[model samples]
Target: MQAAADQGVEAIRILGVKLINPGDFFELLLRFLFNLIVTVVIIRFLYYPHSRRKDYFFIYMIFSVVVFLVCYSLASVSLQLGFALGLFAIFGILRYRTDTIPIKEMTYLFLMVGISVINSLTDKSVSYAELLFTNLVIIAVTWYLEKIWMQKKEDFMDIRYEKIELILPERRADLIQDIKKRTGLNVYRVSIDRINFMRDTAKIRIFYRQDSNVGPISKEAPKQTPPVDS
Candidate 1:
């Protein structure tokens, strides 16, 4: 009975080890940690500082994690590279179908997906050092472009204006000055989008150099003057 009990205990230990697969689990944990650190650096530190879009911040983080986990699991099953590329294309198209994402946002999304794939699917043939270097390169390039290279970005917003008089071609100078004073934005140019003679209102788009000090403003026009007609 003592020998039989010992054998049972040993069998249970073997079963637990088989179920746990400690080696693969450790590898997954290691890769996931690296992937997460790289993603947060890109999205939280690099992108958020410039764009300041909370919605995209959440989307990018979640997208990166989900993509990483999915790719890693599929890779364990020996999924082909083509399958991963196909998955990337599908997600990209689905994102676009929901809304027309801006070029910059799309680019970031691409980076997140690509980074997830690279980190998760890389085989034993690729050393961990090589993987780390590749991620660093991507992060370095993104940081350079976002912080050092592109300085002086132009932003625009559409506004419904009650002052149809100022929208006239002859009053363009006065119009720009008035908008600047009202909105406190450094308005450089204005374009009349539409005129509503019946309501005495005009839709206008204003362009200005985005000031870092002023921070990110919403796409919706500020209500500095009269209430805009709904």
Candidate 2:
């Protein structure tokens, strides 16, 4: 019975089963917890506040979890380089037909994938301290760029302009003035997306720069209340 028990334990260890190898299980749990925390910090603080796109937020979080688990499972293999490269290639080609992801969102996705890969696939040659430092560096750089360095945020809106004549090259200044008066946005530039001749209206996209703290303006600005309300 003693010999049989020893063999069973050895088999469990070789198979990397959580039932007997508490150390391996604990290591996986610790790394997964750490990876999750890092992912939350990056998505919630560094990325979401600026973009406010819930779809991509969901994508990044779910993708991180799946990638981390998959890579951790495959970490026992010696082909780390080829496996890592293939993973990168798989993530690089993701696309959506309805709306192509913007470069900024794609960048955040790339960062999340890289972080998950690094956290999960480290061999014995790498230390926990080094893994942590790498994740911290990525978070620090992202925070600095999103919060400190870039104060101005550019936003856009699409509007249907009835004055198709004003969209002409000669009437460009007049068009801008009219759009500003109507929209109450500090419009810096405009692009004509589509022109509807039947309705004599054109689809226009306007760009404006505003401070990060300021909320984005709506498609139509709302009327302000009388001063007596104050």
Q: What is every candidate's alpha-carbon RMSD to the true fold?
A: 7.5, 9.2
Local accuracy of candidate 2 as per-residue lDDT tens digits, 139-176: 99998988877777788998889999999988989999
lDDT (Cα atoms) of all candidates against the true structure: 0.88, 0.86
Query: Over the stretch 1-230, how does candidate 1's per-residue lDDT look in tens digits?
Result: 97776556555655456444455788999999999999999999999987889999999999899999988989967565986889778977887688878788988998999999999999999999999999999999999988877677678899999988988899999999999999998899999999999999999999988765466587864568867899
Score residue 123 of candidate 1 by CA lDDT.
95
- Evaluate residue 9 in candidate 2 and report its C-alpha lDDT on the 0 to 100 scale: 68
Q: Please identify model 2 stretches exceeding 4 Å from their true place.
A: 1-19, 96-98, 155-208, 213-230
Q: What residue runs in model 1 are displaced by over 4 Å at the alpha carbon? A: 1-17, 154-209, 213-230
Q: After superposition, how far is residue 114 of candidate 1 from its true place, in Å?
A: 0.6
**TM-score between model 2 and native:** 0.64
